[model samples]
Target: MRERDIVGREGRFIAEGKVVLNVLLANPAFALESLLVLENRLAGLTGQIKLCPADVPVYCVARDVMDTIAGFPMHRGILAVGRRNDRRSSEELILAMPDKALAVVLCGISNHDNMGSIFRNAAAFEADAVLIDETSCDPLYRKAIRVSVGAALKVPFAREGSIEAIVTRLQSAGFEMFALTPSGMTSIHDAKPARRTALLLGTEGEGLPKSLLENLQTFKIPMSANFDSLNVATASGIALSRFSRFSGF
Candidate 1:
């Protein structure tokens, strides 16, 4: 199938590379529909293939055939169709978190790289889950999953509703929400995060909406005076790292 076709499939997404395949095989949140591997790469993937449920199909194809099917040179030589099995709503996901929890919330995050990087950081720092707004790109998008090095597959996430509604629900659930913005009132170091915390991030150029920023307790990363901003993904890593450290997660 073409890249777009794979990404556009309902409920299913393409998981590429052996590392991602390994995650897909192990993660109970996703179900493996099938696998497509380069014929020569099959032997190397025996362990991963063995992890697949007996009912899941595995296809081995020639390099040229795989390349033509993918609409590009298939360097990774491993691909799987994975369906999201645990599709929780934002409220359901939040309600499931432990009393002491840390979450990353996204608003209008349209870039796949940023989405993937944020999920990767979330996984690295042991964030309980990621809650995405309606405007954000799907974390399960093929390129995003690839960029995350399979963290997107492993991390628990839910995408639903508007940012305002999601924020309101988080507040109702006793979560202290912190919006990360360049003009944030409190430096991240000075802010006191609660036992249950949710870090809110926005689209790269616009950042969080001014109205949203005004209501939430906001935090900013201390940076060199010359630069006012960081890439959303980099900013997430920095913010999550700091928060995770303080929260002792």
Candidate 2:
């Protein structure tokens, strides 16, 4: 299928590769609309194909045909169409969180790679959910899903409202909001997270809005004097790892 055929399908997305296809099939949060495989690679995918529901259709095509259809070489030789089973609002997602929770909140994160990596880290740290503002790119974007190694399919997230509004809602829900930045007042190692904690991150370069840092409790990862900041994704991993239940903090 062409790029236009897969993207902007309205609640639908294209997932590629065996790993991502497996994630799509296994997760009940997303429904598989259809699967496409390279004919030569079909034998190796029997186990995954069996995992699909009886109603889901699977199509196998020759390599040349597949390449022509995709408008590029199908190196991984796997692709599937998936749709979110439920699109929850930010309020609904927040209300559903357990009392003691760790969440990653993002603002204006337009880079797909960074978005994907953040989700992967969130999953690794066992975060409860990810809250993103409207300006951020879709976590379900094809490259984001692939870069996340399917973690995007596993993490629960909702995109809505302005960054300030999102932070306010989480704050009202008993979350201790921390705007992560280079000039934070408290060191990440020293700050004690509350029962419900949210780590706020912003796009690279500009970082979190100055107004947010002024209002919320802020924390920073200590670094060498020569370096001032970490990439948004890297910073998230460090912060989430510190606050995650597994950290024994």
Question: With candidate 2 superimposed using the best TM-score fit, by how many Å does residue 26's alpha carbon deviate from the native?
Answer: 1.5
Please give the CA lDDT of all the candidate structures: 0.89, 0.89
Tens-digit per-residue lDDT, 1-249, candidate 1: 665666546678998899888888788888999999999999999898888889999999999999988889989999888988897898999999999889999999999988989999999998999999999999999989999999999889999899999999999999999899988888988877788989999987988999899899989988887975899999999888878855553
Give the 10-residue window scoring lowest on summed lDDT in candidate 1: 1-10
- Report clash pairs, candidate 1: none
All candidates' TM-scores? Answer: 0.96, 0.96
| Model 1 TM-score, 2 decimals | 0.96
